[model samples]
Target: MSLVVPAAALGLVAGAGTRWLLVRLPRGAPVPVGWCEAGLAACWAAVALAVQAGRLDPRWAALLAALSWLAVAGSATDLLVRRLPNALTVPALGLVLVALVPAGSGAVQRGLAGAVLLGGAYLVVHLVSPHAMGGGDVKLAAPVGAAAAGAGWALLPVVAVGAAVASAAVALVAVVAGRAGWGSRLPHGPVLLGVALAVVAVAVPGPRIPG
Candidate 1:
């Protein structure tokens, strides 16, 4: 509970900064302040609680926070422009790889492998069904995968499966509601980000599995 206050404060700042950047970027659209505040506050508080619960160390918490920030920005951008700019995804991927350096040689190796595997998988999907998956989503997958790998190797498949299932469910609902058709493009960044965070939160407390 003590962590909540500071976490909320930091969340407010992070949310506002994210929204500010979103507005300034090309094809950027404004999101409701309340929604942004609540979403970011929740994400920040989740990290704080994970640290308090000993599920994650300060370094991992910092990395998650950074990735969450990028996810927030990427999600909003993707929603508006149907594109995830390299500006966000590329820097996020670089940051995750660099941040994992001090986590240990094993972690670095796992993170890199996770990035390659997930990124490559997405690339293949994109190549096969360019209309179904966006290039931006392909880029976003690397960092999300790296974060999952940093959490645990087993988490990579878990996150991937979870995201796929969730995205499919959402798409199915959209089709049922007539909001989208079978071939419609959905914004995938948000789903990937959400799954990554959830998987990290759950897996970080477990014994580290070798990648």
Candidate 2:
């Protein structure tokens, strides 16, 4: 397919580039260059390919996807450092806004709403048990909203349901592997991005429902 070329190529290139950045960047934890790049790139490219196939507008899909990658990277930082660095998060979002002029900035407002919702959810959880949620999650919620909002109304619910399902699956994985325990923190950012991407994939192209 016409889209497959860029999808696969971008996946490889982005993966390699991310690996380079991860290795060269001064950081707290030791992570493999190949592993992180390959993994993240694969996810990005896969989302792109699905979008292309679904016959959605390519530019809109690409724009949201780029934001999604930023979200993924930000979330990865939370997983690695156990903190959301404004140094990284703010700049990434600022760049997103700049690129968004052509794309239109309306989604940014929606993203803010998404962020507020997520922050509120985490806040409630924190009130119930501070240890159950983290401030980093609030930082993580903004872009998920942006991505879904960029896609339009249908995506919000899709993103919510998808993220919840992904989170539960991850929890199940952790529990089955004995990685789950009381007070153990789960990385919600990754799951949020996963839901956004899943919606992207499904919204683009899939089996049609019988009328």
Candidate 3:
């Protein structure tokens, strides 16, 4: 309860920033301001609650917040343009790597390995069926993988499976509702980011709360 107001305030700020970024994206359609604000606020608020509940360290919380914001921005771009800019994904990967420095040697090792594994997997998929998976998604996978790995090596598989299931579910709904056809290109960045965030929230150890 004590954390709610601050969390909400942060959400407002994050939402505004996300909206501003979306508005400035090159060759991108103007995203609905209301949608951006509402989505980002809700996403950030959930992140805040997770941080509070998990009793995460300040550094880890900050990393999570930053990743959430980037994910929001990336998702918006992908949805509008069907592209995730290198401008966003490259810097995010670097930031995630740098942020993990304080987490410990083990975390750094796992993060690097996770990045390689996940990014490579995506790259392979892109090579096999470029139309099915975009380069943007391939780039975006690295930071998500790093974050998941920072949480735990085992969580990497969980993130992968969760993203696959969620994407399939959403695709099925879209087809059933006539919102999309079987050949439609779905923006997968959001799904990947969503599952990564969930895995991080669950797998990352937090400070124990005293009863």
Instruction: List TM-score per model, in order.
Output: 0.86, 0.70, 0.83
Model 3 worst lDDT window (10 residues): 202-211
Report clash pairs, candidate 2: 54-204, 111-146
Clashing pairs in 3: none
lDDT tens readout by residue for model 2, 1-211: 5666676677667766654554455553334555556565676666666556664444455545566566556556656755555555545545544434444556556555655665466567767876655665655555555556554556777777777778878888898899987546787766776667667545535334110
**Per-residue accuracy of model 1 over 59-116 as CA lDDT, tens digit each:** 5666677667766777767776677877678878878877666566777788889999
C-alpha lDDT values of all predictions: 0.78, 0.59, 0.77
Model 3: per-residue Cα lDDT over 173-192, one tens digit each = 99999999997889999899
Instruction: Arrange candidates, best lDDT first.
Output: 1, 3, 2
Worst 10 residues of 1 by lDDT: 202-211
In terms of lDDT, the poorest run of 10 residues in model 2 is 202-211
Clash-forming residue pairs, model 1: none
